[model samples]
Target: MADDSDLPQVVNRPGGATVGEQFRELLEARELIGFLAVRDLKSRYKQTVFGLAWAVLQPLIGAAVFLVLMTRVVGVDTDPVPYLLYVFVGFVAWTYFQASFTSASEVFTRNTDLITKVYFARLASPIAALVPGLVSVVVGLAVLVPMLLAYQRSPGWPIVTLPLWLLALFVATLGPALMASALLVRYRDLRQVVGLGLQTMLFVTPVVYDASGIEGGVRWLYYANPLAGVLAGLRWSTIAAAGPPTEAALSLGVAVVLVAVGMFVFRRFERTFADVI
Candidate 1:
């Protein structure tokens, strides 16, 4: 029998990993990634009476509240489509982005012990954090289908573009998530700021209202929010609403740039995460 003590140890040198090397490491750690994702899913639903129902319930409840407040009370217009269906689609996409961003932002701080003790790729944490939210979004969609059917509406041919729209959403959120997670290692107060920012962003986005309502210079500023384009594209894809294709395309381009910059920033700072955490 071979002695365990005879095994050679691996050493990781500081600033030794290039972007390619890091991605290779991430690929090699795919099993760990899946495990962490499953762990997150189990931990989130563990001991909860509702379990996965919470995913569907949350958006359903929100849609109900907004349906009353926007349609019945305030009378916000969602012409050509039922108000409930319109807002529900927005909620589905928004909920996914919000949850993914929030989870990714706290990936490092939440798993301080694991990062400090383990030798896995640091990127895996944020990447794995995305899985639970993706699951929730899919579950939310199951609830959405019945609502659409009840309203006598269908997503139409545009629905084929859904995968592309989802990819854009992921890219848009990943940039911010990477930046936030990197900063969180050194600044704990950022968690609160991130929460507040997401709340503020909800109103600014076209989640409850139409982007077409904002005209002139103000409209340009509104489209500046990367999520604006993502939500608009999603709404167009799912409900066939009159979303601004040109603006969505431009914003998606911006999101790609943000992803590049964020990756640079994350990789630059990742070497220091072990010490900071």
Candidate 2:
């Protein structure tokens, strides 16, 4: 209410570029992320009779069911590799990515207290959900050892390359997780869409059937799925599948694009999170 003569003109606020700053903030908040992850893991089993065994059970059941459906019922040829073993390997990897990314997408909406108060890496929530799944995947891999022994499958030199395969998987999976998490802040409908999309993707990705089952221009569609390379690379590394390198490269390239697009889109809207979310 100062007199017009004495009043100063109003000025616009400078829009902030906080992506870098936020990343640093996230680094600092790493411990919080770990705690949240551990808490989630604990809460997951709190009421259950079996506890963490439930994690092992899910993929095992899925693998067994798919193995029966694809091999026994459908009579599909799995090539030099046993169909069940091969599909099991791919299923574990794909399940991890799907679970991690889907949970990541819902992070912001899932934890209101964490987002609203006490500044921490906003990205940590989704990253945290990834932990139990990672633990489950590791244990799941261990369980596969006895199965491998039972099947007379031998671990090969290619197994040494698993770390590289996993790195690609992580980056590829994380892109969608982050992208979905950020968008859910504004569009809750995406939550259900992600669930349905993952289901559709599973049928399309050649998890149960060999990539060879697909024909012509449609074959490229499987390669085009970002996870095709991940599933293929995982199978190649673990089971000696020797899938196409060019197609794997294409999958990695698509993953890179998804991550780049996710980061750009997430950053652009991230500032509005505190206000809208």
Using lDDT as the measure, the top candidate is 1
TM-score of 1: 0.91
Cα-based TM-score, every candidate:
0.91, 0.88
lDDT of 1 by residue, 143-214 (tens): 877877787778888888888887888888888888888888888988889889999989888888877767
lDDT of 2 by residue, 1-277 (tens): 6568877443324564556676777788899889988887888789789787776777788889988887778888878888877878777887788888877787788776666785556777777877777777777778878888888887688888888877787888877887888888988787788889898988888677788556677666667778888878878877778655576687889888988888877776676787788
Q: Indicate which candidate wins on TM-score.
A: 1
Residue 145: error of model 2 in Å?
0.6
Superposed by TM-score, candidate 1 places the C-alpha of residue 23 at a distance from the truth, in angstroms, of 1.8
